[model samples]
Target: MFSLPQRLAAEALGTGLLVATVVGSGIMASSLTQDTALALLGNTLPTGAILVVLITILAPISGAHFNPAVSLVFAFRRELSAQEAIMYALAQIVGGIVGTIAAHVMFALPLLDASTKIRTGGAQWFAEWVATFGLVFTILAALRFARASVPWLVGLYITAAYWFTASTSFANPAVAIARAFTNTFAGIRPADLPGFIAAQLLGALCALAFAGWLLREQSDATQPLNAEAKP
Candidate 1:
């Protein structure tokens, strides 16, 4: 295992790459597809595939926490230290900015304008909530029930979420912030960011509660077996 700083750095780099690929691909897909559903599929399928690969490759090194909400949830579960969670969250935010800047340069895209990016309305806020809630719930369950197989399960969760949730299941705060830096179809306007962020955070909190319940149930189930084995 890596030292804390090394792990944090790996997480930052991995998350940066993840967001860059996702937003960059979304831009390309939207430009290519005139149909909304087709464009969404084009954007999210590749994003989900990349997420699976990245998590598999990076989880052992950095815990693969590409989102602040995810880091927070892990901290609550005692899977991550509070100090590490804070550091990881900061790294994720900074990495998001860096990724968006790189994408801008690579694509020769015009600088993002707050006026032109997509607005976050009521529907969008609800979408953010549902998307993030599903993501966090799925991740926590996978960790608890299939600890050794979380990467593949997480990948499937993301893929299914993309098809089901609104906001294309952009559940990661890093990805949301990064999207603000691009004026593409995937981009969210700065003016509309607060609502989306608030919604996602709320969803994360709900997931935490659910995780606690699940953990309690597991502990209760195991206690009887432990007692029976005592001398």
Candidate 2:
């Protein structure tokens, strides 16, 4: 078993890479492609692909929770301690910022800049709620019925969400916060972070509560997937 510190490190490292992939791919996509649809397609594929790989490889170590919303949900379910949940959120946020900086540096851009990408509105907030709800719901459902397929399920959900949601499915609070630091293709205005994060957290809690009821008949529905502090 990995130590708590080691697990934390895995969470941090995995989250860093996840955001790096997200921001980097967006930058590359907008840079290389003229068509908006093609640029979005470019952003979607690699993000989903890398998410699968990251989760699969890091799940055993840290549950591969690159999102504060997910961590909070797990904590609410008692799969992770309150302290651990707080630390995980912190780690993910820190990792996300580092990842943003890394992506900027790789693109020969400034290390830090506020995002001006306006992403605020009722529709956007609602989309975030839906996206995060589906994310947590998928995770809970998959662990019970299709443990082996969780990676792909999540990847596919996010891939689909990217297209379906106006917010491009930022389902992750840490990602939302980190993206606020950049003025790039994937960036979100810092002013928009509060609403997005609030929606995401609420969505996660709502999903866990609803999933508990929806999957009540299943024995594994209430089981803790992150019981060992890992998936």
Candidate 3:
């Protein structure tokens, strides 16, 4: 229903707001509490809530794909042109970075500080893979079976995944990259990015393949040729 440029703008705006919510909430939560679990809960809720809000409002415009991994999955399915997918990714990445800066400005912190927070190791990478895999699966399956519930499905999944996953579920590459620029409760070190991103991409692709198999419909050739004519 929206034009390409308008869709791109929606993507940039949605991703920017999503990242801002993530970083801002993390900063607020950490500042409010020294308890790690409590802080994480604070961060998790806002991220999930924002996803639901953003997706509901912006899905018609740009499919509300705030993550590059999600965008790539759509591109692979041929639901979006490869060139449009690339443009969406670029907008998301740029918007995410701007989001970090927005968060920092709100908190009176320095803009664009490289994160010192370290998040690395096999466990973290595996957690990211699992996290992203679940996310993509949820989206595809919901789109197939319960299209109206996608926003809630995704929101609830991330809310739960945040606590279950060891990495607190940095499932989105754009969000991860944005987090790398903040020295906050939600930040991951820049050096650790490659592994997380790689794991996320692999996980997303696997979900696409699995969903293709699992959600596929039986061929119409199996039905009698006169079935439609009878109706």
How close is every model to the real structure, measured as TM-score? 0.88, 0.93, 0.94
Pairs clashing within candidate 3: none
Off by over 4 Å in 1: 111-115, 218-231
TM-score top scorer: 3
For 32-95, candidate 1 gives per-residue lDDT tens digits of 8888888888877777887788888888899898899999888887888999899999899888
Per-residue lDDT tens digits for candidate 3, residues 1-231, read: 889999989998999999999999999999999999999999999999999999999998889999999999999999999999999999999999999999999999999999999999999999999999999999999999999999999999999999999999989999999999999998999999999999999999999999999998879988658855855
- Residue 2 in candidate 3 has what lDDT? 88
Candidate 2 or 1, higher TM-score: 2
What is the lDDT of every predicted structure here?
A: 0.80, 0.92, 0.95
What TM-score does structure 1 among the candidates reach?
Answer: 0.88
Query: Candidates 1 and 2: which is better by lDDT?
Result: 2
**Cα shift from native, residue 102, model 2 (Å):** 0.9
lDDT of 2 by residue, 1-231 (tens): 778898888888888898889999999999998898999999999999988999999999999999999999889889899999999999999999999999999999999889999999999999999999999999999988999999999999999999999899999999988899889889999999989999999999999999999987847767767766744
Task: Rank candidates, TM-score, best first.
Answer: 3, 2, 1
